[model samples]
Structure formats: structure tokens, C-alpha cells
Target: MAEESGGEKTEQPTPKKLQDAAKKGQIARSKDLGTAVVLIASAASLLIFGKMLAIAVLNIGQRLMRLDQKDIFEPNSMFTAWGDAGRELAAPLSGIFLLILVASFVGNTLLGGFNFSWEAAGPKASKMNPMQGFKRMFGLQALVELIKSILKVAVVVGVAYLLLKLFFMDIMALSLMSEPNNIESALYFLGWLFLGLCASVSIIAVVDAPYQLWNHTKQLKMSLQEIKDEHKNSEGSPETKGRIRRTQMQMSMKRMMQQVPTADVIVTNPTHYAVALKYDQGKFRAPVVVAKGVDEVAMHIRKIANEHKIPVLESPALARSIYYTTKLDHPIPEQLFAAVAQILAYVYQLKMYRKGKGSRPKSLAKDLPIPEDVRH
Candidate 1:
């Protein structure tokens, strides 16, 4: 249905989709791979530790066989003997089983890392529905499982048949051999058989692992509409983004207005542009534009400067240069330093004159040294 509405699932699953699926325990897994690894590990443990295990078992057997007629007659003695035999076998057996356990964990980790999810384990309505169950019973996965089972049975039976045929005389000779030698020979035969069986299962694992990975990727492939929906959900719609941008601009304008009253002077294009400059000898080596804007915002900055009694100067080239080249709360360029310094000097003089502390200062030059490169 998604394919019909949104085109084919041509794109690979995105990282978010893969992560979400893993959180739901939908990671790819190959049971055959894990089973083959455990079986091989078990075979290796048996081959390496067979002598130790044999010695342990032999000790228990000898202890049992050395029992007196009277000892067998007593139930308490029989229980004591069984307890001693269990203690003898425990160490070697535990080592072998622990190796196989570690192998099982490592095999599963090979593909999917380690992921567990209660959501995947929990009961679902689809799982309980009769129609769903019927479909699952005859699904492609079920058919594949059935074929694998048949292949495994065939392979094991064929190998067992060949091994028995090749070793028939040797097996018949086992009955005539002495006890220790017989046990050793039997272990040798069993180890070879176990290794052969593990090899057979490994073939199946090799085929199944790649198939499972490809099937997992196929299952998670997204249609165009799903990709579009995920994008929209994560990033928001165009209209919502536009509204957010407008709100941010309004808030920024308000903040810029708040900084206007703190400015040392306002340079204006007289109608179109206004740039508020501030300088402190201890804080900055050069003048910084505290606020800047055009048209209505320029008008607002001039009105705020008037209310605060901050100096307002009109120098269209200097204003245009600062407005175009400098960002708010950042130092003006080196090219504009001379022009800014002259304006600041004039402002200081104008302040002293207003307080009746000095003679009226000469007016600032009309042609401020605004470099052509910075004259926007």
C-alpha cells in the first residue's frame, strides 16, 4: 500500500530507522550461525580436554567397580558413592559447557551486537489471531526453515552412514580391546565425527548469514512518502518554519532596541540607515556597532537615542560603511577606525560643551575618511 501511494522502496533504511528497529529487537539474526559456532566450540572443548575428562570418568568407574558386595547392599554407601562420582565430573564438565556458552554469545554478537527489547518479546494481537498464524505457518520463512531442517537431517545422516561404513571393522574391534585403550580409541573416533558434523552445519551457517542480512535490509527499506513524513516530523513543515523565523526576527529586533540607549552615538543615512556605535577605552581598542538597521528599524533606533539623549550624527557614507561592513556588537573594520575615532572625539567635545565646561567644539568634517572599499 505504501509503495502504491509513495513509489517503490528504493532507498536504503536511514540510520534512525535502523536504530529504531534495533530498539524493537528487529535486528537481523542467524540461528544457524549461532548453532554452528556452539557445536564447533563444543567439539573443540571435547578434543582438547578429552584426556582429563576420561581420567575423571575412569576414576569414578574404578571407585564404583571396586565396591565390596557389602557396600552395594547398604543404601547409604551407594548414595555416598554417587556423590563422590558427581564431584569428580563437575570441574571438567563445567569448563566445556562454559566454553560452549561463550561461543553461543559471541556468535550472536557477530551480526547484531547485543540488543534486547521487551516490545519484541511481548504478546501481540497478530500473533494470537488464527488467520495470522495460518499465514505464518505457510509463509516463505516457514518454507525456508523446512528446507533447512531437511538439509541438516540429510547431511548428518549421510556423514554418519559414511563414517560407520569406513570404521565398521574398527568399531567391531573395540569390543576386543582392553579398557583404557578402548576408551581412548572411542574418544578419537567421536572427536573426528563431531568435527565432521560441525563442518556440515558451518556450510549452512555461511549461506544463512548473508541471506539474513539482505532480508533485514529489504524489510526496512523505506518508500518515498515515509522518508518525506519522517523529514517533516523531525524538521517541521515550511509554514511552521517561516512562522518561527518571523518570531525570532521580532525578538532580535526588541533586543537590539534595548541596546540602543547604551550606544555612544547614532550614525544615520538620515532616512534609510541607522548604526549605533559604542566605545570604551578600557574594554575595546576600536568602536563597536552596538545596533544597526534600515528604514523603520532605523527610525526606531533614532527615536530611542533621542529619548536617552544619546548623540545622533548624520554621515551617510560612514553610516552605510558601518551598516554594511560591521556586525552588531563587533568592532568596526580598521579602514573605518579613523572615521570612527574622529566622530567619538567630536562626541566627547560636544558632551563637555553641553555641561558648560568648555568652549563650543569645531564641527566634524563632512567628508569622513571612509575608504571606498568599505563604502557600501
Candidate 2:
């Protein structure tokens, strides 16, 4: 159905997809590489410690065979004999086991590093589904695995045959020698045979490593829709992001409107722009823009200022400068200091006149000390 619907996987897998796959223990790893390493390690360990292992085995065999009838009849004596035999075999057996263990660890690490995932280890009912099991068994992946197994076995057998044929003369000559000489020669021949077999398997491992990685990557490939969905999941859906931005802007506007009522005076570009300013002689060194906006938000600021009875002044240059250059709750630029100071003084005097403490001040100067560069 997926194929019919054009859901073919054509896109490269994203980093997030790869990471998720790793978390599920679906990383590329070659079991053949591990098998080859173990085989080689085992062969090498035997070559290095074969003499010690032979001596230990001979000693244990002799001791068991030389046991007297009385020793066998007595339970304690029989137990003691078995314990001694175990001690004789312990060193060589432990060394071989350790070698194989280290080899397996190194081989696995070289491919995928260590990974732990409960999801991979846990049993699932889907695995027991007959259709699913049949699909898996007859899938392309299974076919590839079968072909690899066949090739590996055929290569190993061919190597063994060639090695035996090459050493056939030496093996034939071994029978002409004494028993001890013949045994030593046979052991040497077997070591070389083991090494040859390991070499053959290593070739398979080298080939299988890249094939495994390619297969794993192919399995993880994404379709166009899958890529789009993954990107949306990572970055947030467009509609959700747009809603968040709108909510933030609404909150900011509400906060700005709240600050407008506290402003000492409002500056306006008549209709387009409004900027509310506040200054405290003891608390603030300069007038700070309490609220500022253009268009609909400008009208909102002006309406809030009127409700609070804050003085409103028409200063197009000052309004534009404050609106463009200052942020809410931040002081106006040094270039606008003189012009702002004039406005503040006018407002202070007007307040005193309204309270009947002083005579009305002259109307604010038409040409306030606005800097040429400061005007937008």
C-alpha cells in the first residue's frame, strides 16, 4: 500500500532520525566481524599457550589414571583427586576464555561502540504475529543475509581445501617420523591451518562491514512526507509557532499600555506615533520612554494617557526620535536631552499652575532644542 501511494523512501535520513534509531539499538554492526575476531584470537591464544595447555592436560590425565583402589573407594580421597585435577587445568582454560572475551569486546566496539536499550531487549507481541514473521523471513534483508552466509561458508571451505592440498606433502611425511615428532609436526600444521581459516573469515568480515552499514542506512531512509514531519516535530509546527508569537505580542502590548498611565507626559506625531515619557528628579537622571507605538497601538497608548489625565504634547520630531531610538522603560538618547528637558519643565510648571500654587507658564516653545541629526 505504501508503495502504491508513492511513499518510497528517497530522502536521506536526518540526524534526529539516526539518533532515535541508535536509542532503539538499531545501529549498524557486523556479527561476522566479531566472529572473525574471536576465531583469530582463539587460534593465536592456542599457538602461544599450546605447550602449557598440553603439559597441564597430561599431568591431570596421569594423576587421574594413577589413582589407587583405596583412593577411589574413599569419598574424601576421590574428591581431593578431582580438586587437584581442576587446579591443573584452571590456568590454561582461564587464559583462553579471557582471550576470547577481550576479542569479542574489541570487535563489537570497533563497529558500533556500546549501546543499551530496554526497547530492543523487551519482548513484543508483534514479533509473534504470523504475518510479520513471514514477511521478515522472506524479506530482502533476509535474502541478503542468506546470500552472505552461503558466500562465507563457501569461502572458508575453499580456503581449507587449498591449505590442505598445499601442505599435503608435509602431512604425508609426518607419518614417517617417530610418534613424538609426528605429534609435534601435526600440531604445527594445525596451527597454520587455523591461522589460514581465520584469514579467510577476516576477508568476509571486511566485506560485510560496509554492506551492513549500507543496509542499515537503506532501512532508515526517509520519504518526502516523513522528512517534512520530522522537521516539524523538531522545530515546532508552523501554526503553533505563529500562535505563540501572537500571544507574546499581545502580552507585550498589555504591559506597555499599563505603563502609559504612569507617564508624566505623552509625545505624539499627531496621529501616527505616540511615546509616553516619565522622569523623576531623585530617581531618574533623564526622561525615560514608558510606552511607544505606531498606528493602532499608538491610538491605544493615547487613549490610555487621556484616561489617566497625563499631559499630551504634539512634537512630531521628538515623537519620531523617541519612537525609533528608545525602548520601553529606557531613557531617550543623549542627542534628545535638551528637547526632552524643555518638555519636562513645561509639564512641571503646568501642573503647579493647575494646583493654584503658581501663575500659568508660557505655552511650550514651538522650536524646542531638537538636534538636527536626532530628527528622523
Candidate 3:
């Protein structure tokens, strides 16, 4: 077995296994990817609407800082005044928050097939166990997380240093400069800095996303024994299916034997094969194979035909052709119609002559007019 011998999973997961995992919310996801996406999206939103947002924030700040004399003495007026200022800023604030929300959703759902399950969301005892926590700390996933954190910190520091170096003069000017326009410039500069930091950190997301997907697949891979067990569960045990098939074949043969006694004639290969045919002028356009068998089954059919007094004709070529080309209870192929018609005419003549209505017909010729394609 793939995994059972060495406890290593080697088989790819089946579709059913994937579905079961999805139901439990064991879906591949990278926290870093979601974080990067939100950060970048928020930065993009800021760059696009920086001036209007900055103006809104400044207007709200000024209104909040400069309290009215009546507002200072009366709490209701102060509350009303602050509410109006915050409401004016709400649109820009809502736009930024909404971008973050949408970006995170896109990033998380991008790699994994989307699945949400309460069972996965629910707390587990393993999460609370100190021993499990300790083991997790030393795990490969924990190591990867630590490395990612370090890389992110390094990226952030590097981007910040580069931004400050490029715009040191601009930063100094912002502090010394005047009100609204300087605020706009400052917000614009911060937007660029945030965008750069996030875009640079996204290198980790690019690496992490594929790794998380592969790791999730690795975790779910089946062993050979597991695949076998799952197959049995889904398709039923092979041994049981074999027994059922044998029983069905035996029942089918029993039914075929029952048909042998009712046949008009039994054509035979002398010892190897037997095919019992039936025909009725009003019921069929051609002869139908009622039953057929080989060797031991053929001998048994011959014994039954003898007991039932059905005519047994030993036309080896015709018998082999019917046995191979015809199906049980179905008319013979069109190519054999002439040959079978000859046999049926012979049987009819024999019957008539026995009732003394016509002269005894000549004994059936050994070689009937069998078509080349219908010949065995």
C-alpha cells in the first residue's frame, strides 16, 4: 500500500475526498495573500481619492478641535456638532474600508475553491492544548510563517528607507508648509509609500499562495490502501459483486434451458455446439434463436430436445453460424434467412408427410444453401 507501509501518502486524492474536505472547510488559503491584497487595494483607493479624502478629514478635524462656546456648555449641541462633522467624512472612510473588505475576499477565494463550514470555524480541543501548541511552534508551517514575517519586515523597512531618501526634501517642506494644500501633499506622499511597501511585500504572497495550495493537497493525499477502501465503500466489495454475477448467470441459463423444449428445431455441430430455433408464420418474419450452448451445455440441450421429441438436425455449418451470429430470443441476421428458410421448409414437409397428406419429402441434404458470410 502507498501510505500504509511507511505512513506516506502517495496516491492523488479522488473527487469524493476533495468534496469531503471542502465540506469541512479544509480549503487552501494564504493569510499573507489576503493581507497584501488589502494593503495594495487600500493604497490604490487612497491615491485615487487622496485630495477629497484629505480635505474631508481636515474639515472634520478642524470642526472637532474648535468647540463653540454654547457647545462647550451644552453636551447635546457638542454631540450634534461632532456627528455632523463625522458624517461629512463618512463617505471617504467607507470607500477605503470597503476596498479592504473586497480585496481580502478576492485574495482568499482566488486560490481555494470557496467553501464555508461551521465545523471548521468552530473551536477545537487541539487548538487549546498546550502540547499541541508547542508542537505547532516547532512545525514546518510555523517556520515558514516566521520566515515570511521576517521577510515582510525587511521589505517594509527597505521600501520606507527608499521612499524617505527620494522625498526627504518634500517631507521637510510638508511640515513647514501651510494648511489644506500641504495636507493633500502629505497624504499623496503617504499613499505612494504605502503602495510601494505593499507591492514589494506581494513577492511573498506570490510565493506563499502556490505553496499553500500544494501543502493542502499533500495533506489530503490518499494511500493505496485508503484508495482501495474508498473504492469498496463507493462501488461495493468485489467479492460480493462476483457472487452476485455468478448467481445472475446461473438464473439466466436456467431460463434459457426452459426455452429449449418449446423450440421448433435444434441445429447442432454434432458434439461441439447446439442452437435451438423457433418460428411461427403469423408471429415472425424470420427464425428466432430460442437457446444456444457449447460442449457440455450443448449435450444437455440435446438430451432435453430428445425427451421433448423436437427435431435435431446436424447441419454443422448452419449450427455454428447461428450459435456465433445470433442472440437469444432474437431473429437471425438477414444473411442467414435463406438457409434457415430451407431448414424450416424441410421440418414442415416432414410433419406433412407424417400425417399422410403428401409424398414423403427427400431426406434433408447435408449441405444447405448457406451464404458465404453466414457460413461458420
**Highest TM-score scorer:** 1
Ranking by TM-score: 1, 2, 3
Which stretch of 10 consecutive residues in model 1 shows the poorest summed lDDT?
1-10
Higher-scoring candidate on TM-score, 1 or 2: 1
Please give the CA lDDT of all the candidate structures. 0.90, 0.87, 0.88
Taking every candidate in turn, the Cα RMSD to the unseen true structure, in Å, is 3.7, 5.4, 6.2
Better of 1 and 3 by TM-score: 1
Score every model by TM-score.
0.84, 0.71, 0.65
In model 2, which regions exceed 4 Å deviation?
A: 1-6, 38-106, 109-114, 160-196, 229-239, 278-288, 329-331, 348-362
Which candidate, 1 or 3, has the higher lDDT?
1
Clashing pairs in 1: none
Give model 2 RMSD, 1 decimal.
5.4
| Model 1 score (lDDT) | 0.90
Model 3 C-alpha lDDT per residue in residues 1-376, reported as the tens digit of each score:
5345745578888999998999888888988888889889989989877888989888878887886777767858877867888888788878888888888789778888577998899999989999999989999989999999999899889988998899889988997878898999999999998898899879899999999989999999988778888899888888889998999999999999999999999999989999999998799888899999999999989999999988898899999999989999999999888788888888888888888988888877887777887676
Instruction: Tell me how many clashing residue pairs each candidate has.
Output: 0, 0, 0
Candidate 1 Cα misplacement greater than 4 A, ranges: 1-11, 60-91, 166-185
Q: Please, what are the lDDT tens digits per residue for candidate 1 over residues 80-120?
A: 88899999889889988999999999988887789999999
Clashing pairs in 3: none
